[model samples]
Target: MCVVHLLDNPDSWAPASLQGLNLCGECNDQMIADLRLVAARWDDAQEALHAGAGGGGSERHAQRIEAPVPINVSVSDALLVARDNIWSVVLRLVDDHAVQLPVYQDTGSLAEWLSRSQAVKIAGSADKTFTKNAYWWIRDAAGWTVTATHGAETKVDLPDQFCKRPGCNAQLVVVENRAGAHIVQCSADAGHTVQWDTWTNMLKSLGAQKRRGPRLSKKRA
Candidate 1:
């Protein structure tokens, strides 16, 4: 029943778990788990989309910034799309697989329905690409949830770069501001910073200069 290449162990696909289904045992379980978690996080994502990390209250660990907080409408819109897509998946399960809908249709009920009902019967919805489909769906939801819950930007250190400002020895870190725009700044001083796009251009210019080497003056003679 295998047609596509799988990267995980047992590289080759095995016989379907049930008739007309394409998921292997491990993948089948994973898909159900993903669906269940995605359902559980549905409302949290909605809150994150509208609540805005900068809002008062717990602020959900919102980062304290000196500058006007970046407005990341792109990221917010993406969260909305993720939620809608998740709902679409839930609808498909209902229509195509006869999965029962919860009476309330809220996140809590959706999670409960999946845990109690569909978790056991998702095998009926498996298709050749079911595992991949489930994985792709979970990624966006998980990222948005984590961002909303933590109000933190993922930090990546630049191995080759370090702060040269006096009294500062910290390395450079790259992070996306709330605006969904990338920034490269010193871990210790936000003042020693550059926009990601500007940094990239600077790198390119430096490389060109290095390739051209030092300029030589005409021979004195």
Candidate 2:
């Protein structure tokens, strides 16, 4: 479920405790850890919010400075949305999935609790969507936190890949989150996104097919 993870990588290929939760063990652990990090960075994001430097010498000349203006607003908004979604998912995990954990009042507390407890029940939840969505929620939060705290990371454009969305041929970009997770997404606002492993595996499969050559049809009687 993690963006940095390779679908074919055997290192993360452990079976889930429940068949309903399709995520592997590494992804489960990583998801919880990422959630904790999202909470941890909230303060950092707040500190950097609208703290972008303007034309001034007091800017403490650094190699990279926080992004200014619209970028700040966008990152902040994204982080807020991600946080809300994550909390909602956690609540469902506790109430619906029968997790016996106490929901803390503060974001940091609840996040830390999840990190410590590892919320195995979440990984074993009968709700198949929770695992996948929880990971994405934290993933988006982590990326925004990194952007708000530090300037936006360098987004490498995928030259060969273009957005599959019709009328939107924007090049795809590979975004790396604070937790080392990555996603291949459309550079434009089409919201056409693909997981890294999914894209890589597709390329690999196509390459193998090309290498094998096209199958010939047998002569009919």
Encode model 2's per-residue lDDT on 1-221: one tens digit a residue.
43224333434533443344556667776777777786686556655545553433121211224544433544554445545655776688767756666644444455666677745656665554665556665555555555545645445777666686878988788766555555566778513555455566556544545555543222111
Clashing pairs in 2: none
**Per-residue error at 119 for model 2, in Å?**
2.1
In angstroms, the error of model 1 at 37 is: 3.3
lDDT of 1: 0.50
Q: TM-score per candidate, in order? A: 0.44, 0.56
Model 1 Cα lDDT, one tens digit per residue, 1-221: 42112423243344545454554666556555655665565555445544444332222113333434443443343344345445655676777677667667654345456656764444444554543444344434444444443444666887757776888889887766453655566887544555464456445444545544542221111
lDDT of 1 at 24: 61
List lDDT for all candidates, in order.
0.50, 0.55
| Clash number by candidate, in order | 0, 0
Q: For this target, which candidate reaches the highest lDDT against the unseen true structure?
A: 2
